[model samples]
Target: MSADYPSMTTAEIRSKFLNFFEERGLKLYPSSSLVPDDPSLLLANAGMNQFKEYYQGKKTMKEIGAISCQKCVRTNDIDCIGEDGRHLSFFEMLGDFSFGGVSKQQACTWAFELITKEFKLPLDRLYFTVFTEDDETHDVWRSLGVAEDHISRLGEDDNFWAAGPTGPCGPCSEIYFDMGEEVGCGSPDCKPGCDCDRFLEFWNLVFTQYDRQEDGSMPELPHRNLDTGMGLERMAAIMQHKTANYDGDLMQHLIKLGEEISGKTYDADDYSGASRSLRIIADHSRAVDFMISDGILPGNEGREYVLRRLLRRAVFHGRLLGIEGAFLTKFIDEVNAQMGEAYPELLKNVALVKGIVASEEERFSTTLDNGRVYLDEALDALADGAVLSGDVAFKLHDTFGFPIDLTVEIAGAAGHDVDMDGFTACMEDQKARARANAKGDAWGSFNDVWVELSDKVAATEFDGYDNDVIEGAKVVALVCNGESVDSAAAGEDVEVVLDRTPFYAEMGGQQGDAGELSAEGVALTVSDTKNHNGLYAHVAHVAEGTLTVGATVTAALNAERRGFLRRNHTATHLLDAALKQVLGEHVSQAGSLVTPEHLRFDFTHFEALSSEQLKAVEDLVNQQIFASKPVVTRVMGIDEAKAAGAVALFGEKYGDVVRVVSV
Candidate 1:
């Protein structure tokens, strides 16, 4: 924008929003977090994602009304960045939030006031768009003195906001900053709202008025909210007299830092895609740095996936510049030194965060070479002149971790085009694999009823390791393909139920319990223990006794299986810490399993684990195991646990207190 944001400095924009709301009697809270307690999201995609439980009535208000500047990450548009002027992986949201009650009209009025009165911009430069179906937003905007002509009506796709299938969702009215061009106009003559960046949609006011159902349907919400996010960087670009977002002072500083480290000069030149790579590197490094500092490391799936992609992208650019090693990690300090004051957490754990990035890059560097070699193999596949579809290339990327761009780049180098058809096939197959489940065949009722069973099972104390066999409790329920047997003998299989037992059913990615459920001559070997029709249904692979349905049975978990589980469980913690030490502080565990073969810990870091780094982590974990350190569990307040330097896992909602284990 040629306009110097015509209002305030980046710092002023941040402070003005918070201060205005604070003076209006709203609780001005600092940014809460970038992570979420919800697993459905890859990252804190929205300011409201972390506040979902609050909007869903799962948690009470920390305060009745509050305002915050939140750090948010969105991967939905990952493929669309670099070319766009606005989309970014990491961005700060200047938000005025409310936990309790405040009308949408107030939301509209305050937003209008903040832009007009506080920012001191020309009123004519502002425009508002509301959902045509939302009478409330329309009325509110009108009440706030926005001229009816200045407010455009858009369908739900553009003007309504929903986080997920079932959560707070409602109509949104976006406030736009007019660039005095064709698309910025509210007139009927304006070309649709798609790509003319003439009108930059900056602020959005989402009224959480609906909740979506599991079957992909929407229902009304009781307590609506005012959720808004205006990007600080984008806003700064307009306020700082920059044509492009990357050209802004904030990102330029990071660009300069990235350039210096790579021993490559970044300037406007025809070095093929080198300048683009530099820009991407500069942008993505900041994204990864901020993410790691905020406690997200790179891993395989979800947010970790985003980190992994960013890390690899930056490193790939490094290779293009002839830079080597885990140089991206070293820039963590540069990021901290530059933006740490704005985001202290980045500076606070700078060392740990850097190590995570450094280690991942070192690992991904090799992966990159291998990935390139793998593409060469694909090029070999293309030598016969058979069209290599995107599917085959995608597999090389998926199974072998080949960077997709490298694959395409290599293909282009080989004078061969990729099979766009094959890639789609492979992509669809992966989606199917992700969606398929035993429960899927059971209809929607499977999860609906079974989820209630975990709640129904009396908090059975699982002492399987100490003692697998326990006294019998009454059968809670029965599940059968046919009629119930007399005694469920050793070889005659039958579904033996349990009211309570010491069995630790398969959960947390652990294998199901397999042991004998016995009563006198009726000994049933449980091949699997899973939830069926809201009850723990023990599948006895082999049984002979004709057990009656109501017979009391002793529930036992397999001793060997439990021991294996313990080894795996204990190893998980060891590998987790080792990963942090070898990788970086940013290496928060994403997911892992300790199987009979070996321990696997998925962590958030940009690059893959190098042989040297992975070996170091493996050695460190083994060292702890050999040291015979006691894996001690301590019960204390959740706050105390955090204060005691305990690591918290994602998607776990701890109570006022928590159970923390340390070695």
Candidate 2:
């Protein structure tokens, strides 16, 4: 460790990184919600997810540049957590971006200055990597005074970063810290590229220059954008002079709690299994605590399934330490206390988080015993070398909450191997079945046509919140069964894209507006509306005449239904306010749906709401309605609204401007 490097807490390290960037004129952006509103993603897996609209040209930049410490979770590395010293299910990413103002030169210069001058780390200990063929980044690193020998030119698989199969992508330059040769794999080629413990990569700087299309060809982006991410835990471990990320203050409190509960010491060389178990428990505690604080509950699919798996794994690992009977819930307080200052939501939802974890632990405890019995029976019936069926393993996973790792561990002890390929196939089949049965059905992925159309036309103008009838709206495009059509005749059900709409699309847990479109000789009934690539597509059934592209129509919302929607929408806000007043400030809306018949709200509460409590909430809402609390609605920027103490939904995506409702 360098003697000049000052020792700092994890929070301090995160603060220093953001402060350094903000001093250079970068606007600070708060971390976005863990749940993603994009249909392609389950969670906000990266800091750039919130800024994707700006990159794709659907929305303009809020600022020329921004800085943030984003909270992210990735389960693809879940299986590698305890086995390695650096993998974490939950971690903070300190990032700085330049939308179009700065170039790669300025980005490289700032990163180097902060690492060397601000943080006071020795320059000799740092190494850089760039794309093999990208002479631009290579030259920039060299211009920053990095030694030629200290920079490595690597291939696309190593230095290129992309969001997905097709989207914004660029070649990246990564900074690595040399931890020394003692931890190396004892090979001559054990450099930064080697997968060894000797070199630790801490930050990645991406120069977003290409817009990769679905056809595998790369075109230059409209503007050369810069995006960078530095792992907070990794940097903390280095500054704190710790060998492993979990050994630092970021996880020490939870690990100590694990030791106290299990009555065991964490010794890597003890071989008594205490060290591995402690690491697993400590890591999982953070993931589970943050997820529940964000209002996620234990369930069977999607983000819910991921949460259930994490909690169950933590409980099972507790069993390994000889700690049993819902002990994982006890660590919730420690998790909140350790990191709640930066994230107040953790403290607010502490009680509900503990409740959810305890309930899940209790449920999985019983399922474990039953799953063991089934596993033993299967092993006894199988021949000596026979493999376990994937269907059987998936049943234990889907029906019971048994992780496949446990099943594999038990089967391996009995001298048998699992058919992993079969298990994977079964898992895929289940996912497909679930998607087919979803409420959105196949319509969820019907946005490709709109993506192409958005390139030609501007986003749809929303006028429903202000006007009930939007006259002279032009029809932009039409689609029937995923295929674009020029015209749709009478009695044909089709999706219609318009230049301006008076219908509210399905968003923020609110139902879409039901309305009608009328022309001289044509009438169409819009059964529902959905937001696709910033365009509102009305799922309309034409009752008469052909609706053609480039034709004008008058869009009007059904007066009766619109009245019901307004009442239910206003009631939802009142109920939200009442829950905070009646229960506690910790209560927040988890999910909601407003239909003409009724309004449903799912909030963060540990236990079932009692009849009296339900009655109290109902009475308060009714009272507000009777008082006619002058339902106030205004259009303002998101920042102004938040500063005025307006409540923001947890998982809803808002634009630069938002609609604020108050009573």
Error of 1 at 484 (Å): 31
lDDT tens per residue, model 1, 139-191: 87777777777788899788877664454677888887765563344565663
Q: Compute the lDDT of residue 144 as modeled in candidate 1.
A: 72
The TM-score obtained by model 2 is 0.81
Q: Model 2 over residues 1-663: C-alpha lDDT tens digits?
A: 444567789988888998888887888989887876566667677777677655655444556688889888898778787876888888889999877877788889899999988887788888999999889888987887889988999998999988667767889999998877776799987778888888899999988888788799999877888889999989988888766788789688888899899899887433236788788889888889988888788787788888888888899889878995778767888887888999998886787788788878888889999999999998999999899998888888878788898899889999889889999999889778976765531112333567556666678999887798988999998989877899999989998889999898887667888889989999999999998877899999999999999999999988788788778877788888998888877678888899888988878766678899989988998898898768778999999998999998777768899888878
Give per-model TM-scores: 0.66, 0.81
Q: Which residue runs of candidate 2 sit more than 4 Å off their true CA positions?
A: 1-3, 56-58, 163-168, 211-217, 268-272, 375-395, 404-507, 514-556, 571-587, 604-647, 653-663
Q: Scored by CA lDDT, what does every candidate get?
A: 0.68, 0.83
In candidate 2 the C-alpha lDDT for residue 274 amounts to: 72
What's the distance in Å from true for residue 468, model 1?
24
Model 1: lDDT of residue 198: 65
